[model samples]
Target: MAVRVSTDTFEAEVKNGGKAVIADFYSDSCVPCKRLSPVLAEIEEEQGDRVKLVKININFDGALAEKYGVMSVPTLIFFKDGEEISRLNGAVKKSEIVSEIDKI
Candidate 1:
């Protein structure tokens, strides 16, 4: 399951977790974000305890979006050891996401 994130707790929850974090920076009004939600869920399900997903709504957490330089919705950023290692934008296929995860 993806953890809903806010600017206030984004760091504590993602950066310091000591695990790889897949942060999905999205907005409710974005069609592509909606399309990618289930795909992310499937990744989480298949990955099991190997990774963590953090869902951040840019509408409510604008600061986080700016900090991460997310100019668009559905920006998937992968963090390991509290640092960003990879990213993907827009609605992407499940295989692409899995491939990115595998790299990390």
Candidate 2:
């Protein structure tokens, strides 16, 4: 399973990790978020050592959503060295997300 984070763990896992990070900013009510959940889980299981999957519930942790300008559900943000590199603004395929991260 992906490492699910809340407002409390955001900074430690993302800002201080000093590695590439992929965060899924979503809400419980968003269907697309649910749809993307399994895909992310699979990716975590398959490539856990290479990339860290961080799942954040927007409703509970609005700080990151607002900070990242997440206006929609199933937003995927990729960051390296605590800085954002790219953002996918909707439910996306696993291959697509992986391809984007590979470039980073």
Candidate 3:
């Protein structure tokens, strides 16, 4: 399962994590976010050893979203070694997400 993160926990959970981190910036009211949740969970289950999945609710953590330049919901930020390597916006396919994960 993807862990919920707020501005206070963002750095500790994502920036300081050892494995590749997928920071999902989403909103509870977003349909795309709802659709992406299960996909992310599946990915987390399959790649638990290689990745750390964390979710930042944009509605609650607007500051964190602003800091990351997230203009919309369901944005995925991929980090490796505490730095952002890539990102995906909107509803993305599982293959696309997995491909990006494989690269990092």
Ranking by TM-score: 3, 1, 2
Candidate lDDT scores, in order, read: 0.90, 0.85, 0.94
> Per-residue lDDT for 18 in model 1?
61
TM-score of 1: 0.95
Residues forming the 10-long window of minimal summed lDDT in candidate 3: 9-18
Per-model TM values vs. the true structure: 0.95, 0.91, 0.97
User: Model 3: which residue pairs collide?
Assistant: none
At residue 31, what lDDT does model 3 achieve? Answer: 98
Record all residue pairs in model 2 with backbone atoms less than 3 Å apart, i.e. clashing: none
Can you write out model 1's per-residue Cα lDDT over 1-104, one digit (the tens) per residue? Answer: 78897988888878765668899999889999999999999989889577899999998889899998999989999999879999999899999998998898
Which residue pairs come into collision in candidate 1? none
Q: What TM-score does structure 3 among the candidates reach?
A: 0.97
List runs of model 1 lying over 4 Å from the truth: none
**Candidate topping lDDT:** 3
